[model samples]
Target: MMQKKAVDSVMEKIIAQDLEHKELESNFWTMSNHKWALLAWASAELDQSAALVHLDWHWDGINDFREPESRGELSALASLDELREMIADRDRPVDYASFIAPAILFGLIDEVHFYCLQDDTTPGLSSDLLDETRAKEYRHHNIDDLLRTTAKLSKPILFDLDIDLFNRATPFYLDGPEYHERIRSFLGKCSDLIQRAAVVTIAKSPSNYWIKNEGHYDWDEELAGELFNEIVPIVR
Candidate 1:
């Protein structure tokens, strides 16, 4: 059985107070890498179990996060640099593609509803750390499915987005205008969910070369900015 650490720290209390005061200034974050979202998720003052709505171009469910020696391991992560060192453990491999598994296993999130532009080749996550008894996983191929599932979630939500969701296998896949429109449209549809989320993490993923196409190194960064602009008004 997974041992869940108590989340009654002073920071958590402060977060609760902030929510009570309608002070949501710091609940949203943008990171250069996807794994750093772990920091945002851990820092939030959410219920023992929260629902995760992840939008990305890839599944990111590889499930190789080093098992925490104690339940407090995630709560102990103080900074993105510390998280970088933790995920850098070569043998255990807690990377961008695997960070979600630890969050679920550690009880920060109890269920995941995943959406990706990529086809649903990965049916589901099957790992030793994750079983039927642990977190539940749901996959969606389009915005309609994601919205339908999210509308039914009763738990506090952690909304995660990877800018690569707008990427394709080849360079200049959708053209500038169409790509911008798609990003805006998707965010517009999810604005209500984004506003209700207890925590929101956005990944820039500029170095995702496999799906980014060889020469288009900074395209995702551009898209990340576009995503940021789109989200600002909704959360404001």
Candidate 2:
């Protein structure tokens, strides 16, 4: 049995606060948000030129905030100061929707293999921003394909998992016990390649921003705890 007590103390506190609110707004813009914090943590642990195995519902690789021309110039940013200036110009240094773009621009990630759920909606990447070399570096595959092909990779992986990938509407969705089992099985299969991992559990709250207002799911303490229990061991 996955122990709820095993959840991180800080996460436990956050969930406790979330339970008190009727609808916790998505705080992806904030530096204190778990998404940014986890990415920051992963960035610190991962070496330059590491492969990021991004498993999520959304593409999240787009340069949405900046214009195509401006983003195309990111390759020219040689120093950390230049990169900081670029991000600061957008007024959002680290946004969840476009963090991967900056990470790639800054050479934090050399390759990104996106494993998204099977859906009709095709997310497009800016052609101007990604030239031939960079375009070849980014590849998209369905989740099932990822499961089948991930075992073949010998390279060190930075596993980036978004819980929303297993949205309630998807076949991967399950109650706590089954969800735990599936995650364990999946991670066990890819454990050898995973050098470090980051997990993001989004509740999909009502947002005035670009995000769609899907009726929020209550992924409070119980679900968060279960997920934490399963993920912590593999990543650690």
- Residue 135, candidate 2: how far off, in angstroms? 4.0
TM-score of 1: 0.70
Please give the lDDT score for candidate 1: 0.66
lDDT per residue for candidate 2 within 118-222, as digits (tens), equals 465545355654663373344555455665565565545456655555454455566656765776776676565453333222322211221211234444434
Q: Write down the lDDT of every candidate, Cα atoms only.
A: 0.66, 0.49
lDDT score, candidate 2, position 151 = 56
lDDT of each residue in 50-149, candidate 1, tens digit only: 8989988778877664455543565577775666567544343566677787777667888888886555566456655566337778888677888988
- Clash pairs, candidate 1, are none
